[model samples]
Target: MSLSPLPLGGAAPSATRTPSRSAALALVFGAFVLAGCATEPPPPPAPAIPQYTSPIPASALVGRYGLAAYHRPQDATRTETQARAQCSNPYVITDGPNGGVMMYLADDTKLTEVISKQVPGQPTYIGPAEDPAGGERDRQVISFNGTVLQLKWVDPEIAKRYGIMVYVRCP
Candidate 1:
């Protein structure tokens, strides 16, 4: 091949020029568009647990007691005497692993940790951990006078089946 004279600029002469700047600009623009479209979504909020305070502490109720179940509100007084007679086979309440009390849920034989809670305009209740006061499985403290404690389940069906619970403290 014969040698040719050089042009004024240092660029070489070619049949087809490569559009370097435009190609790179197009690639960069595409990357930005894709990045904008593919951005990650914000994470969901965490679950909230409610907090409550109890006027009556669990320690006050932890002890051996005779238990009786009665259907009517008037029968509660009568059941207290029956519960007192049941001291031979007492229902025991003990301190829980945590700073709560250990008691049996409705229809459950196994003991579970329960927290006492007092809500405004509502009676005191004891229920499972993390549950709201007067929850379905909770038991409302109808009355507790150091000697006798009356509890009624929050669930209507359970209340009908188990009735009002009377716990008479044993000597």
Candidate 2:
């Protein structure tokens, strides 16, 4: 395109003076931020502890016990909803470094399809430790005498089948 003549000895404005995209976006963003500043929402309030906890029970290891809950995938689809809900095992105390008792929580519990019947070296089809239980495989007891709680996974194949883990503890 042909350029227009200069006016009163002033040089002709260059066509290269077009604004950059980032400059345009910054201008628009600044206007938007200024508009939002006029109507900013108030900050959230502090969390309120319940007053019903009048007298707190004192335990040397209450906080030490990790909170355990089912961590299976949420039933979102029709197929997953039809499947059984996995169970989560609670915390247990075991000897840690320096002979201290370390509380551990087990969360992941999933049902995997049984593929093989027997291994090369194994004799039996599968032992109690590797077998899924009969009727829950449920039957258990938790004995806590205000201090130490003995939790033994009693039901046959409960630990083996469900894959009870103890890696992650409660926050």
Candidate 3:
């Protein structure tokens, strides 16, 4: 009794049951690739800087105040009017070196005054002057005395020109 020679190149009969090793390897690689793609989101950005404005203190006024508050004994009335007129013309006030006052106005009206030392840092406009120079010359400089609001000027000329002292209560 002789068995027939097994066919070396023909298709095998349909009962194959072995698992594929390459297919298992591909499944694991796909899972690892998917896991690597997952990630956490980043954090948000920071906030903006604050803007501060100067406010007037009512206690600093001496007597009945006028349009442009008095800066000195001499800067009583006339300078007050000029300052008020300057203010009416949309003027801007700035600081100068050696604690001076720099005033800017439209149509070529500029004035500079030197007096005491100005408070450090940028100045903020409070509002109209309460003494002589009407609504026009109504400007003040920002300052602090241990957290207390103080108006300051360095220019004596500015004080005289504006009809008020270099420093005063904001109002």
Q: Give the candidate number with the greatest lDDT.
A: 1
The CA lDDT at 81 in model 3 is 54
Q: Quantify all predictions' global Cα lDDT against the true fold.
A: 0.87, 0.34, 0.38
lDDT of 2 by residue, 1-171 (tens): 987778443656776675667889999999999999989798898655222211112222233333222223341232222221221443433433332233322232632221111233322111122243212322122233443322334344555444322122223
Compared with the true structure, what per-residue lDDT tens digits does model 3 show for residues 1-171? 976665444535447744457878999999988887885546665444222332323222221212344555575445445434443333233454433334332123555332222123644443322222212333444343422233433344454554332221222
Q: Which stretches of candidate 1 lie over 4 Å from their true place?
A: 1-46
In lDDT terms, how accurate is model 3?
0.38
Off by over 4 Å in 2: 1-37, 51-58, 62-143, 147-171
> CA lDDT of 154 in candidate 2?
36
**What is the C-alpha lDDT profile of model 1 across 27-64, one tens digit per residue?**
99999999988998788886565677776688888999
lDDT of candidate model 2 versus the reference: 0.34
Model 2's TM-score against the true structure = 0.20
Error of 3 at 1 (Å): 99
Q: What TM-score does prediction 3 earn?
A: 0.20
The reply for model 3, stretches above 4 Å from the true place, is 1-54, 57-72, 93-151, 154-171
